[model samples]
Target: MSDQSSDASSRPGASLESGEAAGAASGTVPEPVSEGPGRAKAAEEKPARASTRPVPAQNAGPEVPKVPAYLQAQPRPDVWLRGGHQPPPGVLTRLRPPSPPVIGPGTLWSVLATALLSALLLGDGLGANLLIVAVPAALGAFFAARSAARRLRPWTAVWAVGGLALLAIPALREAGWPVFLAVVSALALGSLALHGSRSWPGVLLGSLGLFPSVAAGARWGWRGVRVRADDSRGRVRTAVRTTAVAVVLLIVFGALFASADAAFADLLGDLTPDVSIGDSPWRAFLFAVGLVGALAAAYSAAAPVRWDGITVRPGKARNRAEWALPLIVLNLLFAAFITLQLVVLLGGYDKVLEETGLPLAEYARQGFWQLLWATVLTLLVIALALRWAPRGGPGDRTLVRSVLGALCVLTLVVVASALRRMDLYVDAFGLTRLRISVAAVELWLGVVLVLILAAGVFGARLLPRAIAVSAAAGVLAFGLVSPDGLIAEQNVQRYDADKTIDIDYLKGLSADAVPALNTLPEPLRSCALENFERDLARQEAPWYSSSWGEVRARDILEKHPAQNHGTECYSLGQESDERDGYEEDSYDPY
Candidate 1:
């Protein structure tokens, strides 16, 4: 047995001899072992160290060296990683549990109040009710979310204010498109404000994601309820039981009392809301819209995703020659076009009409749409140029500014040319919805170009946000200006130029144009306002369904109602030269 032990101990790493022999290669010292009885007895007398450290298996691979605790890298507090258990080698993993939803009693009450207000005040029509619904919803969201909002920047405040201001447009104007724009823009701004999104793409994504967040909010609210079940279950049950008992008692006793007394039933009928089965679906829809919208706003404000981290990879940049060449050529092309346009504009119409062999109206219509399209395409080109242009050095930035600046200047000229064409077209023809709509769009595009030019001079980092805000402002301005009213005014003025008017066209205008159309003399006024007066007379609208424009129109029509000239106005419209058959294809601006 002694010989076998000796042989076993002779193996590498088994005894002191083998350790001493391999010390030069392994660079590690082995612990001393007792070779005799005396030494063994001494070892047993000494205190033993814990053997908590891992031991290698006999057939296992070579053990890795352990790093000292002091020398190993420490985990950083700010850094976070994501994955399940057994993460990949060299990868740091962090466990991030989703935050519990914040469904406090106040938040619940706010959501309920907003929903109730929406059901009562909205869906009658987009009138006073729109402003009424928006104000409470915004206030509810603000109160619910104010505590959790991370960075309520100045721009967020601006957006919030802008959203409320936009909602008021419906109460001010009766036009459908303007009201539609106001609602969409208000929602987008509200989304941006709730999330405190500053970066352009972040703002855009947050605004767009609001609709989908409603579903997420529902789940969040459900999870919150489940999480607090232990704390809230008894109270909820008690409240529900009390409410159920009260409702049952009220129904049974109220029915009996109503049968016993007619006066009491009449009072109850007046006190109760007149909610019919027909309106239940619509009111329910409005309530849901309000509830979900408020909850989603609060959710986003409390736990906004770090959307600024999302970056779009720019296109591979090109050298200055490659980038500047096409842009310079474009600038030259714009310059040449501008020179020609100046000739046509400055030399007066007589010379151009003679040269082109076209009528004034045809000449006006020919290039207006094309110029508008060119302006739009030029903006796209500038965007792509900025994306792909080399921006590595000061010289590169200067080059970008110079080249893009010149292009923008020339594009401004193109914008001017387009507007000029539209003016001429409007002069020859009469104003229509399409004409004014396109004109507004073209003007907005011009504003965007000017903004880009300013960004080139200042800094381009905030350009996207600036452009977005400008667009919102433009939409608000357009809605406020009341394009239909302007159309009516312009067409009425044109009636003076040629003693003929399209009374049929004016009759089709909304209540927004009533004030303008009312200025026409006698039969023409009656003919133009006949349809609007008739429509307003038919509506027995409540105060919530009344808009400023509609109310004004009603008062005006009441003071000076349309006369019974009917067929005489129609006969005059038919005989007028304004109804002369013109080719619509030639005049189609779009």
Candidate 2:
């Protein structure tokens, strides 16, 4: 039995052999099996375990406390789970979307139309000019606002329109204060109503509507309150301070200048007109009130509107055509009205001449009818050219064709008029004035030809180009043949006759004479010099007036100059002709 036990213990797998071997190796029973077979195996197989006994728990001072569950594990971050992975540093995270592109023929056409309207309106009176600026600005604001909030577009439009209406008050000044006030009130109320909803747009509209009135009131009167407070001391103080400063400045300046030069005193005295301010304070106050009210109304109308998140894409081609047709029609209507007025003026000339019974020579000399007709004809031709010109084509061929046609028409008319004039003169007056008559006809014809050439060169598809060409032609022709081509004749006559002062001959002088006449004294240099010369000629005694004996004496008197005349008379008599040299050759004595 002993031998069997010994053999079993000595086997490698026997627990007794391991225990004895570990005890003999200076170790107590091998450390109790760890939590698993692998741990137990490791403990049994380790050389260090064979050399050491297990230290009892009591011997180790207070076995190291197991880590609390919360602290036992290392921290796992929340961001890592939530954010997936960190992006690279310095990379842009948010980018704006690309803007929609402007496309198609309508976009280009709209821009052109707006530009034309802007130019035309700008050329109109001050009121129209203001509208030109305001309307576009308002539209721009509306679009901007609509982009922000689509719902705000209507409100923005209302505000802009209101502002424009208020501004229009200054334009129609003939309308009394009541009308102005009513217009302003209606605009303000309408703007408010349009933006009644409680939104950002509404708030903006309300503020804008009130701001102008408030500002204007403050500007014109001290009635505006700067702050909401019970005490009035601040307001009173401000008023007093302002008044004191103004009075002090006025008094100081008045005293200082009182002792200065007479001119300074005169200027100071004239600073206030003789008109009395007394008993009219109410009128002045009313004017001030009206001004403030108008300004306020303007402000209320000009609020910025925002239409958020509204995108506007171009309409279809058919829609564009629809819009374009109306615009074209309107332009044509305007042109027609202008033409009608011109035609009326042209047809009225014969009646005017007949009523006046002016001789053809006198009529030709005056050139009032000729110039009036030319202007009317030029305008009519230009209108027709523009009307016929094609607007939406690829090239300016249509405009070119129209210009050429109009020019041809104008030239024909001028030729026909010249021929008619020649026939009338030869048949009616029997006057041989071909040189002057032909010169005038040639001058106008040359002008028309040059204009046609210019219009052809520029290829006048555009209205401005057409207008410029017509204006240039008109100005040149008027300069050349205006008043019977007197400008050219005046220089020629002056060269030949040493100072030809024919009052009747020089009646058609241009506004260009204003600057030249400025160098001379007022009354002496007046344009009335012509009338004075005419009166002098009429006063001269007719040849038929003399009796038989007086006729011979009168002829002798007409042949020689009067004695004791000044240097001016001597010079004039020397320059005069045999017909009336002996007459008072001096300046008018009356």
Candidate 3:
């Protein structure tokens, strides 16, 4: 059995001689074999192992290169790599939430709307007025409630209520309490509805919408109370209260105005003429009360009490140009119209001249010849100014400046003429044309110059402030040195001339009669006369018996060689008789 086992082992794997020979040839160390019973059993169960080959060594480098903590933690690139979570780039950096826009005390749209609404309501039928009130009020209330729901501040609501109250107060006085209440309610409700967005601007506009109603209500209320009050004390009290209320209303209304200055000016103009203090023992008391109330209300409403920082900045160049272009065009048109009208009146139609009994051919020829020269001279001056002046040139500036300068000359001339008419100054010329002499023309020219200057200054942007200063200076100079201390006085004269009133007649009237006729003072006598003339012209008198007859009669009498009738009525009494006779003759076939 031993001999047979030896033979089998030596046959292939189990040969000691072959193992020694392999170990000697390979020159490698062998691994130790397991000796435990468990190992011996594992070895018996193990399959024959394959020839082991030498394996190559792997690179001994770090798994990933180490990055700096600062680099890894960078906000931009790191965030980009992770996901799009970084702040956006570009001009978006400038984009931030904006603060609310501030609105002025009064808005123009609101004031205008209120004025229109008031006029329609007061001027139109009662039903229309009522309807107007209802619609606005309903809208205001709806908005107000909505605003409240939206957690808008109560200030908007207060302003709306105050505005409505103001509107209703005047209407109530004028139209009666019922109308006032209805209108007020309507305005309040409408304001509430329209301003539901809780926007200050909307509320402000809504408040403005109620201004006219308030003004009307105040006016009517004050007038009614004044008229009804028998006792001076009561009247005084009412006046005080009314004025106080009006001032309060004005202040409140003013808050809604985008421009405080404009609003104040308007308010003053509206209220000044109506203010009066009664001759009563309670006058001082009432006045005090009114003053206190007005001041308090004004303060509360944030009315600008004083003119600090009231800089009247000149508008942009574009605006100035816009104003200037129109003004220039208007002046040119006016001059043309005047020239044309004069020409026509003098001699365009022979029939017109003959019917009017005017020396049409002769006057036309002479007047046209004189006017042609004057127009040529004026045109020449304008041409020179335009050609040599700056882009918005010296000529343009001079157009306005010269106009203002002309006003000064004109005022002096007018004053001189007035003085002469009052036997204050006598002209060297023996011309009996005392009414509209060269001096009067000069005065008119001066006024035109000032207006032109104002336009130019207001139009130009570069030197707007300077221009405004110049304009203001001109205004001041005119106001102080001119016939009256206001530019309005000059305008009044122009208005009067257009109306065609007799200045002499107005000059002769008593002071008491002057106001009744809505006449200006002695300085503005021409204006009063002009207004009177317009009033007369507008009177629905028979067409043939008025100034038209006088004009015709003057023409015919002047033409008639035998009739010395033109000089027959120089005295006031004689003139009256002549006018009466002319009317009678014209009406009755006597």
Candidate 4:
């Protein structure tokens, strides 16, 4: 409750209660540890014995082992740290078996409800729809943290804030696969702080597979569900089971009977309640599967399984030369690209067209994605070097650092080039949701590469965590920039300057751009509104497509009122109905 793990441990009986809950979260008996020949059997049995005892009260002082005189000068936490490189907070804690998260009725309800909502939201839905799914996830993670003896990571808070921002940004949501990748990346990094996993691989493993592992436990939950107990808790259970089976049989028969006759089926349909997961076997099966998955995640969130499969062995010497030489070569290639970019920057648009012999739009299109790929490739090279670079002579280290540093600095120029290219492209061809979203990501990744380079050069060993933190910061910053609104504003500005604009496309943009569209002038404004209204007409106010963006767009349209605008916003359906039996293809449906 205090937002710190120590407070829970301080309570009488809390540890025992936590242990019992943890056991429920897993519902598995831990295998007994085999003792070596010289080891005392009692020593091996100590933990089992301790677990059986009542938790000590706060007034009952925990005996602190006295530090040796030689070690007294060092701080308590740092006394054992001979190496200057400090591992992230939770890595050392992994030495202990992972405790279960804090789970209750609240945790179960939140998980199930959120999963149901999210399953229903499967589409191109963005804006608040993204936030709608994200908050519940963050809450589920937090609940697990609260249930366990681990405090939520400071990065978890960052994760939550960033998720909120990231989801709300309409452009990112519509960006497709990249948005999914970014979201997953954000989750993995946040869980590092959330679950207090120190290893990058462990964080990745746990976050990515949290659901699968938990869902795998569905086999455990299914144990009782599959078998009908004739004497389950005696006669009362048998009677209840019988009654339930009878009710199910009757309902099935009644539905079948009704369906045999049209009038009877119509009457039955009217009487039956509208529900999402009905008696359809497929729907029921899918719903049950989702429920199992949610329960599994909730269980793990309360008590997580540790990812010990791949243990990161420290202090293995890497071949410094093998990783080093390639980096030097790549750095030189980047230096060449950056030098060429500098000349182009100074020479302006005319020079770019003159040299390339391509028009402005074609030139802009050709360069941005190529620069983006180059930047991405450079990052991979840096990351690989960090992971595999040999630790050897001081001279090798110096050379490696200088090349990496130069690459990082040069990578910034590439980043700038990519951004300039994208800006030029967007200026020529008005902003789409994907372009806006990717531009933000490009800037963020560029920042991350810069951090990676800095860590590599400065000899700060927390490269993984720093990259994770920078990633979280980048996501948060993108949200803060309000990408959807910016794209709308910028595109509107482009329309003003160029005089050639896609009115239909602007109307097709997310509701975040609605406010910005109001600034458009004259007949263009009329056409834009007409397009928007037509699209809005096709959309129905159902839970599946519901979003704040839609709500805002509808509200804006309400004020304009088609009659006052001197233009008709007619639906394709309406036109079709008027010309009844007209060819379906006659309508564009735009």
Clashes of each: 0, 12, 45, 8
C-alpha positional error of residue 546 in candidate 2 after TM-score superposition, expressed in Å: 52
Q: What lDDT, from 0 to 1, does candidate 4 have?
A: 0.59
How well does candidate 4 score on lDDT at residue 54?
A: 51
| Rank list by lDDT | 1, 4, 2, 3
Top of the candidates by lDDT: 1
Every model's Cα RMSD, please? 10.0, 26.7, 23.9, 24.3
| Preferred candidate (lDDT higher): 1 or 2 | 1
Model 2 Cα lDDT, one tens digit per residue, 1-590: 78976786586445633553544444344445566787567556653553464433332233333577679886765656865556553311121122212111222222233443443333212332344444443443233224424355454444444555555433322113322343444344344533332332333343334443445323422322222223466766786799899999987888787767788877665443232456255445533443343333222222222221123333332333343354455445545644643563687646656776865535443443464355456556544544444445644554445544544554444445444444444333222223344545455554555555565666433333233233333333332222222333443344345433432223333222222222222232333233323333344322222112223323333443123323333233234532222232544211
- Give per-residue CA lDDT, model 4, range 404-470, as digits (tens): 8888888888888888888777765567767876787789778787776766657565665566667
Instruction: For model 1, name the residue pairs that clash.
Output: none
Tens-digit lDDT track for model 3 on 65-136?
357767888565565565756766433123211211121112212222333343333332233333434333
Cα-based lDDT for every prediction:
0.75, 0.40, 0.35, 0.59
Using TM-score as the yardstick, the better of models 2 and 3 is 2
In terms of lDDT, which candidate is stronger, 2 or 4? 4
| Model 2 stretches astray by more than 4 angstroms | 1-240, 256-264, 270-275, 278-375, 385-590
Task: Highest TM-score: give the candidate number.
Answer: 1
- The reply for model 4, stretches above 4 Å from the true place, is 1-153, 156-194, 216-290, 312-326, 457-461, 472-484, 537-545, 562-590
